[model samples]
Target: MATRRIISTEKTILDKDDDDISSPVAGQQQSSNTAPAVPMDVILKLLAFTFAMVVVPIGSYFLSVNTFFKGNSTYAGGLAAVMANVVLVGYVIVAMNEDQSDQLEAKKKAGKKE
Candidate 1:
């Protein structure tokens, strides 16, 4: 009987391109606490996204709706697309509001702690 050994040629490489401020790495001093900045960044990103999605479609809808599509149900695809955009913006704003409330709750908890 002969015993055979199996070897993996794949090398396990850990990428350090991602910087986690919470994890203190040896030989390097991490600067001030960056936790507060994260929520603000997320909020700003959402706000920008919300405005882009809402404003662009609205501007184009008005610009083309008058000259292009005459009736609402005349073309199924055109009407469906308009309705879809309206529903999408509605859901996005709901999500944005939820995130805002969650951030407020986090701030309240932090305030209670201090």
Candidate 2:
């Protein structure tokens, strides 16, 4: 009996381009080339609401379970669920208001242009 060895060449070769990989320190104007998809204020609001969504539920669960619910997990869980829904509704309301403001600003700009 004879043993045979097998070789595989499945690796892919990638072409490197100068524009694809750039050092930010090397160019000062690189950041100004493209605007962010989401505005900074919008991103900040999203982050704040996301944090509230997490903290509000857990905090309410713990606090209410001991203080208000008298260690009744059922009531605590229910309160947590309600708090989560409240946070969700609040986020939606805030987003709607922000969108309305943006539309109003656009309308104002259009009016000025005309």
Candidate 3:
């Protein structure tokens, strides 16, 4: 047990030395350089999602239930909620697919490099 512990400690030290010798990897460290700008599409998606989930549902409830369409407010509110949920789910699915593709591409590039 003592020998195993010593070997493990030595291995960790060696790994630390290796990491220190290497230059910083991408995304692990941020330098003084300005960060890359986020794509417009992502910004738009976030804004749209916020509006759908936060604004539309509450606004729909207040407007339909209290102001304009009191008799049909229940239906309007329900529809608004459903639509927001649908948009959220759709956005999640799309984002997941994009991430998966990016990961797969990274793996392919890594494999080629190896």
Write candidate 3's Cα lDDT for 27-81 as tens digits: 4864566766887777887788877778766776766765566668678778678
Ranking by lDDT: 2, 3, 1
Per-prediction count of colliding residue pairs?
Answer: 0, 0, 0
Q: Clashing pairs in model 1?
A: none
lDDT of 1: 0.66
Clashing pairs in 2: none
After superposing candidate 3, which stretches have Cα over 4 Å from the reference? Answer: 1-31, 37-40, 54-70
lDDT of 2: 0.87
**Highest lDDT: which candidate?**
2
**For residues 1-114, could you state the per-residue lDDT of candidate 1 as single tens digits?**
999554465333332333453467787876777567556766876687677666766565665565667644345446546755876777677778978999999999999999
Instruction: State each model's CA lDDT, in order.
Output: 0.66, 0.87, 0.76
**Candidate 2 on 10-56: residue-level lDDT in tens?**
33233234434555555655555488888999999999999999999
Selected candidate, larger TM-score, 1 vs 3: 3
Model 3 scores worst on lDDT over the 10 consecutive residues at 1-10
TM-score of each: 0.36, 0.70, 0.50
